[model samples]
Target chain A: MVKVTCPICGGKLDIPEDSLPGELFEHEDCGAHLELVINEGRFELKLAEEIAEDWGQ
Target chain B: MRIGLAYDLIRWEEKALAYTIKDLGHTLELIHVPESVFYLTEPTIRGLDVTFERCVSFYRALASSLTLEAQGVFVVNTFDVIRNCGDKMLTTAVLAKKGVPVPRTMIAFDKVRALEAAKTIGYPVVVKPIYGSWGRMIAKADDESSLLDILDFRENMPSPHFQIHYIQEFIRKPGRDIRAYYLWGEVPVAIYRVSRNWKTNTALGARAEPANLDESTKELVIKAGEAMGSGVLGVDLMEDEDGRIVVSEVNAVVEFKNTVRVTGYDLPRKIVSSTVEALKA
Candidate 1:
């Protein structure tokens, strides 16, 4: 498991090692949606942008 | 009532929709379209009163909705409605055919013709792809020189769509544009996306505020929605320099995340209810 910290609320969370780079999951303590990205085998979390219904143009 | 949600990702709209579906005392079926496959014979997916086409991909959304409807499922935005509104050209044609006002537009196939069409429409015209969202690939050609440059860039582009030119008169308006949510021709919520940029898409950092829609604007929005036979749609309107409301675009699979935020209206509840109302008949 990868230990991740929420950037918004500073909450600690664990992400599975096998999770894909673009996998989106919610923070346990704050419920903020975060995307897991792997950079050179290191885990980085990014706050996922909310998509509007007709997002792409 | 049993409802099926066909989607690619669970955005805030979907989450709220699920909650509203449950709260409305209906069974929710999350049918992730990306993982699901269609069969020619006896697909076996049943018990759905109405399946909402919430997929992000326009092609996939239309195809899946049509496939599911073929297999005895009713999609919220029917194939006919989605098809009409999905294409920018078709939307404009329908609106114009229905006597609803739209910006003057011209379509051309090559650079020379595109330039000719631009000259006819005058300079600083808005150029956009036939099928797109978020104001991406939408630009303005200030003059013959810049228009040629813009067309030249698209000339070398790989996509065949770029080969076709969609040029329209740029409506100089107040620094804001209106995006209204319509369910079966009813305006549930409307918001003004305020931005200094000419392209005022909420996704492009436009500040969303509640819109004060006039009676005529609301009526025109309904007409625009009905023209495309859309049960759920996003009607984008902008006032010209003369304050005339010109229908800009109509989105079939409408998104209301920003609309909900600005108005605090029960976006999903209205969607679910409007869908139910549409199915009634």
Candidate 2:
């Protein structure tokens, strides 16, 4: 498991080891949607982009 | 076969699709849209049997698929399908030409003519922008004043696309609509997006329930797909007061998250497997 900190709630999140860079996850503690971003083998979490006007099925 | 998933933001559908591709023992390439740059003329993207366009934004999906397709990479739903489905006017026109049942629709370049068309179509008309999704900017005008009020807002919009009005007769549906997943020539699964609200889009907080497809509905779904060039489409249909089904919209980059939750079907796997299998044929 990959451990990361939730930027919104300062809570730790257990992410799957196989999670990709662009994968999105929601923080259970604060309900903040996050994006898992990896660079130089280091993992960081950032708030996911808000739904765009043109977003839908 | 090598596969690429070009995405703006990876949602549940994207992750499930990627896992399905990997689990099936195919090479998976994740093309993150925001960080990646596409060379239009030079063409750096290559070597993928098929690339799934999963971008949330219709414009982003269209541009990304166009770039990859230019490099001879086969894209699901194709550029033409995306372009056609992205615009409400094009979707309605294409479906109507294919003999598919569609709501009575009219187009006007200006707000005054739009109000005029709406008046002709009668009250309780739906005014939609040429380009939008998730029921954004879709409004119902119960009468001329309401329609004029709606048109007044649309006329002042800076974007020319929003300036053009596409009006349709409001079909009084049964508090829900059918959302069918059309893959290639067949509809593997479908669900009813149920809500008290007139707009039954799941993105607008509708509840999804598994819908058994009848023969007539299935045929309509397939026809809609064929009309849109047949590649992964979300064919939405509504039952009018007269009990006739009409094609409400066809979506190119369809989301299956809710359908999976309600139906317990591995839609991502089905979509991936069928797409890759077709390429091998």
Candidate 3:
């Protein structure tokens, strides 16, 4: 179990490695959508708000 | 090297590939694909060793066969990615689910739900066919009556009808959108598609001009392509009202005549190189 801290609200949550690629899981506490990016030997956590804001900008 | 170019012969873009292949000293076999191949069903799949009954299935079959048969098969924007990108509803859902930036979009199964969703999203929404390309069947509903008229027209259509989820919000610059061309996950060239009309597609007679790519735009294009799992993609983007670059659509196999004219890049050579690498892998 890997614990992920939400970038938006700074809340903590656990995510399994078997979670679907590109799946958007919301933070239970803040309702902030979180995304998982997987690459070679690297994992990145992204906030949904950032995606929305980046595209809007 | 021998390369198999698979596309419908009726499409003008296919000729572009042939020209490029000939220029690169490669033997190109132009395989004409039928529309029925894309919409194959059980009844259509009789007496074959393999049966492709769905659009996705057909795409996979085509890709797998080419990948196996050719020494360096360049499937110009692969069929799997094309199948996914061609469906607006599916593409929107997948992008949104994957945390990609798109407009406020919704899909409805029927006309009533579509109308309600349109109203909820507000006026000036763009209604598109679920499987449309080149900006066909796209209607801008500015009021309730226009929305209703579109729905009524759609409902009265012949077989295989579905209500598309329209998008409403932050109308961007008209007749201006960016097309970032990627080959093997790297963007070699980009173009700004400009038009006097609402649609910014070469097929719609839009003019193409060279565009400079900033780091942010490049990053966004790469991210959008990665999200869609397409190695080669044309990431269509537009700046919204807030100047944020929102992804409009992602094309797996993009026509590059206009892009090449603008950027002066040898697109087919790049694609062939990528195809060789992919096949080796």
Docking class of 2: medium
RMSD of each: 5.6, 1.7, 21.8
lDDT of 1 by residue, B1-281 (tens): 89988876666777778779989999988776756797647767878899888877777788888898888998878888887777888888889999999999999999889888988999889998887788888899899898888888888988787888999999997999999887876897899999999999987899999987888899999989888886888899998889889999988777888888878898889999878877885
> Cα RMSD for candidate 3?
21.8
Sort the predicted structures by lDDT, highest score first: 2, 1, 3
Name the regions of candidate 3 deviating beyond 4 angstroms.
A1-57, B10-12, B22-27, B34-76, B163-170
Please say which candidate is ahead in TM-score: 1 or 2.
2
What DockQ do you compute for every candidate structure?
Answer: 0.17, 0.69, 0.01
TM per candidate comes to 0.85, 0.94, 0.68
Model 3 error, position B25 (Å) = 4.9
lDDT of each: 0.83, 0.90, 0.62
> What lDDT tens digits, residue by residue, belong to model 2 across residues B1-281?
89999997877888899989999999999898877898889868767889999888888989998999988899997999999999899999999999999999999987678878988898789999888788888999999888888888887888888777899999999999999999888898999999999999887899999999999899999999999998889999999889999999999988888999999988998899889777877
Q: Residue A12 in model 3: shift from native, Å?
A: 75
State which candidate, 1 or 3, has the greater TM-score.
Answer: 1
- CAPRI quality of model 1: incorrect
Q: For candidate 3, give the lDDT of residue B168.
A: 49
**Model 3: per-residue lDDT, tens digit, B1-281?**
66655542212244555566668776754333332243222232222211111112234434543442232333444445665676666677677788788878877767678778877887877877665556766778888788788877777766363444454443657568898976666878899889887667777788899999998888888778777776667789887667878888887556677777777887767766665576567
